[model samples]
Target chain A: MTNSIRAEWTKFRTVRGWVIGLLTAIPLTVLIGLLGPLGSSFDCAGPNGAQCRGNTPPIGPDGTPVFDTFYFVHRTLTGDGSVTARVGALRDAEPWAKAGLLLKEGTTSGSRYAAVLLTGGHGVRMQYDFTEDIAGPSPDEDRQWLRLTREGTTLTGETSSDGRRWSTVGTVRLDFGERVELGMFVSSPQHLETSNTFGGRLDRGAPTVATTSFDQVRTTGAAAEDWRGTAVGIDPAREHEVGFTDDGGDLTITGTGDIAPIPASAGSLGKTAENALVGAFAGLVAVLVVAALFATSEYRRGIIRTSFTANPRRGQLLAAKAVVVGGLSFVVGAVSSALALPLVERAELAEGFFQHPTTWLTELRLVLGTGLLFAVAAVLAVALGMFLRRGALTVTAVVVGVVLPYLLAVASVLPTGPAEVLVTVTPAAAFAIQQSVEEYPQVAASYTPADGYFPLSPTGGLVVLCGYAAVAVVLAAIATRRRDA
Target chain B: MSALHAEWTKAWTVPGTAWLLAGVVTLTPLLGVLAASSMAEGGDPARTSLLGVTLGQAAVVGLAVATVSGEYGTGMIRTTLTAVPRRLAVLRAKAFLVCMLTVAGGTAAVGASVAAGDALLPEGLSIAQGPVLRAAVGSVLYLALVGLLGVGVAALVRDAATAVGLVLGLLFLTPIVASLVSDPDWRERLLEWSPMTAGLAVQATVDLGSQPIGPWQGLGVLAAWASAALLAGAAALRLRDAS
Candidate 1:
């Protein structure tokens, strides 16, 4: 068994292509992980905005300075009422920019609210309490009808490609009352983007007011006949402040900052782990290829025949390969992630954002768990190769199984339920292990994919992935005994 | 014509061709049903209905690449060429046969997948819808073109493993790398040009304006990629020794 292990190890090291693939994993991980945060710390662009801003944690009583500010065309909705209008145009924008309609508890920027918004380029979103950006329709053209209806505490957001037909974007039970404010709004966050990797400079484009026009307004059920509006969260020294005008026919609003649910103050590092762990996917890809090729390449070259002749014990041979591939993948995943975390932390902190400090044990668990994820994925790939005996089939199947779930779950366009379902069922369930940000069912903050929560707990998710690997390995073992090489 | 028959026979005789094609048939609808079943009420019905095409294309690529590269692996390409001394003709024959098989499999797979989607989805989604019809038809062509891409890459590399990796990487990874890019316009451009992004864009029923490329245009981009790949494969086949 030892000799077989050593021989297999020799073969693994001998493959130059595999070695290069493994070596390249580190830099790809670094590039993806470290580079994502380059723009996370950027200050707002344009005149009078030369200040440390936008990076402030929205966990404030008044919310973050860059966000939680918007100009509104408002009216009081005492009961069940819907605010609907056709947005004529959205122009002159920022990346994290938005304009839409909202149902709010108070006119205060940090107030509990439900809104249907059209982002500058990111598409429509139904956001509540300043953070939970539910995927909305990517409507046809720039023209869209936005409506937010309130019945008691429940708010329903609907959009229309044309005014006659409506698609419900989403519904959320906001913590608002009967006499809540309903209005049209526009705001833009500080626009900073990472054009390149860490070596490349961040583009801090000047913040611009996203001027938007809302026409053909109609209201039903207890709406204010004499509607009033205001620039919520105005700052005396704020640059490019939100402004508005309500003509009899059309309402034009210009604003800066987001309108959603926000906590009272900067408390903990909610998204820091997600920020640090951008290397996970890149590392997983590199590891997946190398791990998959380990077993499949043997069959590809007919070297498995020679190896079987030497070992005869097929299970031992498979086991040895697993050990080798699993260990290599683990080291790759662990080292890359360990290196990535600090870079992400520095980038986050440098921008004056508070990353609620985590325990050392938590960090250690994340690093080890990330490594374990790659290792299990590697072993699974090996088993898949053995059973399938074709690199293309196995690799493709594994990718479809693992990566597809993650992609669907993260895609802002898809509904959140399928994303959660995918995470629950697929091998990507292991990603739950990397999910350090715990979603408290009680703490009704912004816990959406903008803040992600896996359906399963970390251990449970890993077990699901391990279950896949185990079943595949068992089938491969049984078949190895019965099939011809 | 005989060469085409010979290549077709060869593909049929291969160890897992039936299973591979069967896999395409079964998995397409299975994934489509699963996606549709899990879809939220507000999700794009057309895009959701044909979501299986994305997964099913991998099987098509695998089958197509294997049709060519397996011959190289087993040293049967020499016999294939000896039987048909015109190397380009043999390549073309293989290309023609693979594309036909893919299109046949693609049509069944896509048609059934959409049917499953229509069955599984809510009331608003229908195959009768214009965008859904285009998406369904375009997906078949997309699969056929992807198969050609596989055949071309396999011929160029002369190995199943490397060619599969290369094709999958080109089809899948570029979009991922492009998304990581910070420049919005550049990212959109990257998506517009990447074969997978452009090709798969055909399925989008809603939010046409936001797509990097139009549905027909996206399929055209994929078609261009397939053509370029097949031409390159033919050139490689003619220029190099049979090995």
Candidate 2:
């Protein structure tokens, strides 16, 4: 088996076109990655038409980009304090709109915070930081009493239908300074609407504001300063009006913008690390072509008969060929991906595009998974070539089955749901291996494949592609043994 | 004239040619049903109904590539060149035949896809409308042009798998890479020149102003690609020795 494999490798290396083709994939991947960021500029329009530079979103406690804009009505609390308010009504609210009491270390964007809020659609939720959410007792939308308390470093959230009986929703530990802001807040994220069109999708976002009326507001262990309204992280360019009116404790707040993890959706300025690897698809096409020709050319030249006679074991010969092609492709994918990641990220960063943070472990998976993706796809192509023995048909079947689905799904052509279904089911599922970001359920963002969010987990997607490759290899082996080479 | 006649006979003699032509017809509407059913009630009905052309074009490309590359694979090209020494005439004949067959299959496929769209979509299709009529006719022209492009590529490469791969990479990869560009100017420039994106713009019955290129101009871009490829193949055929 080793000898056969060595012989196959020698044959592959000897072919000038095959060697050149495999080499071509590396440069193609890197070139696309490097050039993808070119000609794209980021210039934010500051208030009064001034150019805003270095306006990247604030980083959360976990180092993720977060949406930290909301209307805060608060007063300083000395220590071990609690705030309670009855959310009387929520008007013109988007589904994910929030209205309730919050306790935070400061009024700064992305500061540590905890809240028990009544959502426009979901009844009540206890959320902390930017990524954590716990459901409250009721699913009711209006007239709910919400409370938050702090004892030393421990924070607790409770909800009540009336002012009399209460239920503890959830609890967590968060250390704050000697004084903290405790008050009522309101936020409504941008409203998103997707319309399906021929050959593409149209994603439209309009700014939406939520008005929440709070009454019977009470504070404990607080300073004597009067309540103040601050528009934390609000963008004046978006024409978001965030303010509050305190009519003798009958407070009303109207705000546009959310306090949650940033989503990879339409109308978002945040990009993922894998955005720089868009050129990987181009390299994949080049590699698959070379792999297809590697097997079909042997049959086209009648060299397979000589190979079968020399080996005497057709299955072993098939395995040897698979090893040679798959191994070469794996190296090509891994090396190119590793080289492309840093260069593309640097270029995009220079252009003022802030990439969502990713750990080194996730980056490592991305690089290796790309290599495995190329390896398995090459094996699948080689197997299909052997089984069909028609070069044109085999190339078409694999390319059409793999690349076309990805194009349709990620090119903004299909709607989000159907596009998600396409990536999940097709061999294109393997593209998920390139995703370097995670989706947070607490954030109501468009989780489409086009937005760098895939339906399947990275490992699961690779497994699906491997499943296809394995089936093709087994079938090819059976055909090779049964047929007269 | 004899070259045209001889090429037609050679093409029809192969059973694969008939099956591939049938694939163009069947696969076109089969995907149209899936695509049209997935669409929500807003965009151009004519364009949505004709989405099957994207997949069906693969069959057209396959049939076209086989017409030229199949002969080279079997060493039959030398025999044909001996019988008719004019190589350019042989290529022209093959290109003409591929276009004719693709146009016939494309028309049938587009008709069935439109019917499927009418049945599946909320906004029914009517061919009597100006844009709808243009989309139907332009789609058939688009398929023919793609077939011409495939034949030219196959002649230049002289290998079926490599040629199909190159042509498909050109057809499908451009728009995908283009969409990833964050710069709207570059994205529009890439789409304006892309064969598939530009050619398919002819199908848009609504939102014409928003398209990067107009219908006639987009088809012209594809025609430019097809002609350039054909001319390059002619040059290669004249320069290279026949194996």
Model 1 C-alpha lDDT per residue in residues A250-292, reported as the tens digit of each score? 8777777655433222122234565577656766766676777
Instruction: List DockQ for all candidates.
Output: 0.08, 0.63
**lDDT by residue for model 2 over B98-145, one digit each (tens)?**
999999999999999988988998878888889999999999999999
Steric clashes per prediction: 13, 2
Candidate 2 chain B: minimum summed lDDT over ten consecutive residues — where?
Answer: B39-48
Residue lDDT tens for model 2, A13-54:
999998998889888888887776775664577667665453
> Model 2, stretches more than 4 Å misplaced?
A42-47, A52-55, A89-92, A139-142, A162-165, A236-241, A266-268
Q: List lDDT for all candidates, in order.
A: 0.73, 0.86
TM-score of candidate 2 to 2 decimals: 0.94
In order of appearance, the predictions have TM-scores of 0.68, 0.94
In terms of lDDT, which candidate is strongest? 2
